[model samples]
Target: MKTPKITIDRIKKYLAEGKRFDGRKPEEFRDLEIEFGVSKKAEGSARVKLGNTEVIVGIKMGVSEPYPDSPNKGNLMVTAELLPLSSPRIEAGPPRFPAIELGRVIDRGLRESHFIDFEKLCIEPGKKVWTLFVDIYTINDDGNLLDAGGIGAVAALMNAKIPKYDEENSRVLHDEHSEENVPLTKERPISITGYKVGDKILFDPTREEEDAGETKVTVGISHGIISSMQKGNETDLDTEMFGEMIDMAEKVWQDLVTKIEKFIK
Candidate 1:
């Protein structure tokens, strides 16, 4: 793919002029669109679009024996895949470094926030537990997949319904007449990632700006508190910048949380 020289130059010029290429003011966010239940077959799923970037997240849950060390808690697993077919630059194969990095980042966000509430997932104390597996797929690598994927995954998990377990039978009770459904509790985490380019910090960067970014940072905020942080690809930020970004992220996170909460209901 030919990198748009004009696009790069335009953004660069904007930076030089103390402006942004997209004409939005500094600290502005792109138009966002989110939907739950995008996948009909999955127990729960969500799709998030930020500008041209798009990501889809799905959650599948099952019953399993609790680990010896954490007999009373459940398990939460997260995986991320960047489909080569989604972007020309990506190649088909085992997940490359980017895919792995994306997975780890999201995992930190959820785990650090105590979002899963594993203790509550315990079905039979040391015998059984609810395992939540969150899967994220990049259908389009426009930009900001981390934020989109993170939000999508959390939203999907919030809406997921667990099937009843029959510990005596050592199986899940999926029979329509006998199966029971469970919903996640109210204490869940939400995240929003902001990108800093030049002197401006933006809510969600488009593909072009992302490619030109000097540094990228992902922040996870849960219930109005900062939970986790991950910085990747580039780094030139100073202490002041970091503090400012955190403040901006706190505000942005609240707005996103409000919207995502609606999907749960």
Candidate 2:
């Protein structure tokens, strides 16, 4: 949906005063909620909501031959679908640019952080290995699907359990389950996205604010380190602005990770 020029102007005006149409401060984020085991069929599943924006992620595991270069490690794939029902801006079709970009950004955040111990996923060295597939679905698009989807994916993986395998029969025993959890690293990665409007920067922008914003920066943090970063839209951000964005991202991530840990635990 195209936002009227007047609305854009109003948003920019409000940002100048550190206020939002929803009465939130420029740096304030919407309420966040995470629920696990939302899907019975999925090995692991979670639904996350950031105010009105919502995303669901499912994790499935399968056995496959290991990659030639990384024969000792398993593989992970992430995919996203922005359902038309979620918002008018999204269309019903195969995954498009937005969907692919969202998936890749989230994938990079997790993979680069080494969040999962891929070596533990190998069923046999240089042979059979576990492949994890993360599927993300957007249920609502009030705004900031990237953060919501990333959180949902991580939560789903945390809630997942490995299924029992019958190596001799070369089959997965669906009815059996492993008592251990998936191998994961100590660091927990979270993404924080900042939107630039005029000369002001804001966090957790609503759909309206996003429509008015000119640029976006998404920073992924893990163990007090930046694992990855992605910039979106066409806009020039000076070094000072970039530094400010990362500082804000780090502060936000500190708070968010605490909440996520409590929920996952």
lDDT of 2 by residue, 1-265 (tens): 6888999999999889878899987777889899998997788899999999999999989999999999999999999999998998887878899999899999989888989999999999998999999999999999899999989988999999998899999897755777768899887788789988999999888888888889999987887798889999998799899899899888888888888888877
Candidate 1: the clashing residue pairs are: none
**Each prediction's whole-model lDDT (CA):** 0.75, 0.89
Per-model root-mean-square deviation over C-alphas: 2.5, 1.1
Q: For model 2, name the residue pairs that clash.
A: none
Q: List residue ranges in candidate 1 displaced over 4 A.
A: 2-6, 16-18, 173-188, 262-265
What's the TM-score of every candidate structure?
0.88, 0.97
lDDT tens string, model 1, 104-215?
Answer: 8888888778777778888888988888888999888887788888888777776666765667787765432222333454555665666667766666777787766778
- Report the Cα lDDT for residue 80, model 1: 93
